[model samples]
Target: MKGIQSTGPALLMLAILILAPAFAEPAPNTIKIVCTTSVLMDPATYIGGDRVEAITIADPTLCPHLQGDIIPSRIQLNMDFIPGADLFMAYNDSNDQRYNIPAVNDFMKANNYGSVTWKTVSDPSREWNTPAKAKLLAEEVRGWLVQYDPINESYYDERYGEYVKSFDAIEPTPAEKEKLNQTQVIVMLWQREPVEEWLGMNVVNIFAPEFALNGTRTAAKVVDDINANPEKYRNVSFIIENMQSGELAKGIEESLKDKGINVKRVVFTNFPRSIEGVDTMAEVLEHNKQIVL
Candidate 1:
């Protein structure tokens, strides 16, 4: 009975000390992770886990090109959500070089924050048009994820490997393969970049219009080509990216309607609003299945 004296108060005090760190909030200088788009944010969260907080500036539905000029407002917003962001993740590429990169760079420079360019981080090479390129990009993304959390390097590697596997899983069904063989889809992209090349390689019977943007000359050329060989290209479809070709879709849709040539559905590459957890390219493609090649 000598050992059973009252240690309850002392134990309670010790317990309080042990749980004090948990109860105390994180410091103002804690590391914060910011991404350019919600799509980019998804993978960041998966990789960062609880170690870092993630934030996105662009609305998932709005095109990054059209994010508008509210720099002061954005700065305030960033300050509020990510007071201690250590790094920024951007997804701007050569296609977006004209607008996205400048805007993101300006913002970071003005705010004096560190940033990692997605294009630089991903380092897309000439193989972007091949399945090998897709695998490479996936691996690059995995590498970035692991860089932030070295402890979970193996986990990130496995996740990215799964992503690559899923992308390769997209084999055309018999009907799709038949369509692929018979139909010569001309992917009229709004932007002239590796995306068209990538699509052309994977979709096989696909071709890109001479011009990537929607203009009177390009539109007329497309119409002329179709008219010249209507019998051969009747089943042909057009795929447009929402980011750059939103206006093109309207123009082409109208132009085709006026000429009585009913083009197939106009698929948007990126959505009109911000959607959470759309990390992988496969996920982006699957999300827009209605416009799949």
Candidate 2:
């Protein structure tokens, strides 16, 4: 009788403990932030830590300008959380102005929800893939968090310092740089900065979308240039493609391979979660390095 009595109470206590979480309320003062892209979400997540709930609307794998069927579906799925969001953030670039913002607005309006008053976190149309930009983004996110929740300023500042420390650890070592410097690469226009300038690789040529700068060579044009002037890319061993920009270097890779030049192609994503297990800006940088190195 005594064993049964003691065991019954213990079992009840264990059950109550397990079920407590299911009935628990969210932490007080938890601010919900709606970010248009993972570029903003990644930093917000790291800097905000447990204090903020950050969410992204767009598919990081696709460019902001290209509104495929996925964007609409995502907005619909996130509609539940959209209404009570404390803050809305975006790049506010031409792409966001045209597609992302409108998609969000149209959805909100149709549902009778007011227009989103977005906080701009990035320069218009600027890329956020590089390490330098990533650091700047962390600062931007920290600043925004502090401004929004001044009471948690110290907490955000501490988290920002920790994030920057983690970022600094991923900086390529001199030996890694030497290896990168020895390799010749062909890269997408958006990926050129990280590959050539940051990684210290010898960039043989760059290919871009047809709508890029008037003088910039499109992928097809790059292939033509490569064939016309083989010497320029004779040593090119790798083609770095941008995931958001589509496979702009496919023709270039195929052409090089057809000409008996073996070149490896690697795609890099600017946003977290676009690649498996790459959930943060530092991991994104590390992921890019691991694939190429």
Top-lDDT structure, candidate number = 2
Give candidate 1 misplaced runs (Cα > 4 Å): 3-31, 68-75, 81-83, 95-98, 108-119, 122-134, 165-175, 190-217, 227-232, 237-244, 250-262, 271-280, 290-293
Clash count per candidate: 5, 0
Q: Tens digit of lDDT per residue, candidate 2, span 166-277?
A: 7788888999998999999988888888888778899888888888878568988888988998877878879998888887778899899888888999997777888788
Clashing residue pairs, candidate 2? none
Per-residue lDDT of model 1, residues 1-293, tens digit only: 44555677778889999999988975434337666665556555554445557777665655555556643356557765543565666655543465544655666667776554443445522323234555665566566666755766776666666656766765446665454454334444432233344333222122233443344446556556555655544444553444433444344445445566565645545431333554555555555442454
Against the hidden reference, what TM-scores do the models get?
0.64, 0.87
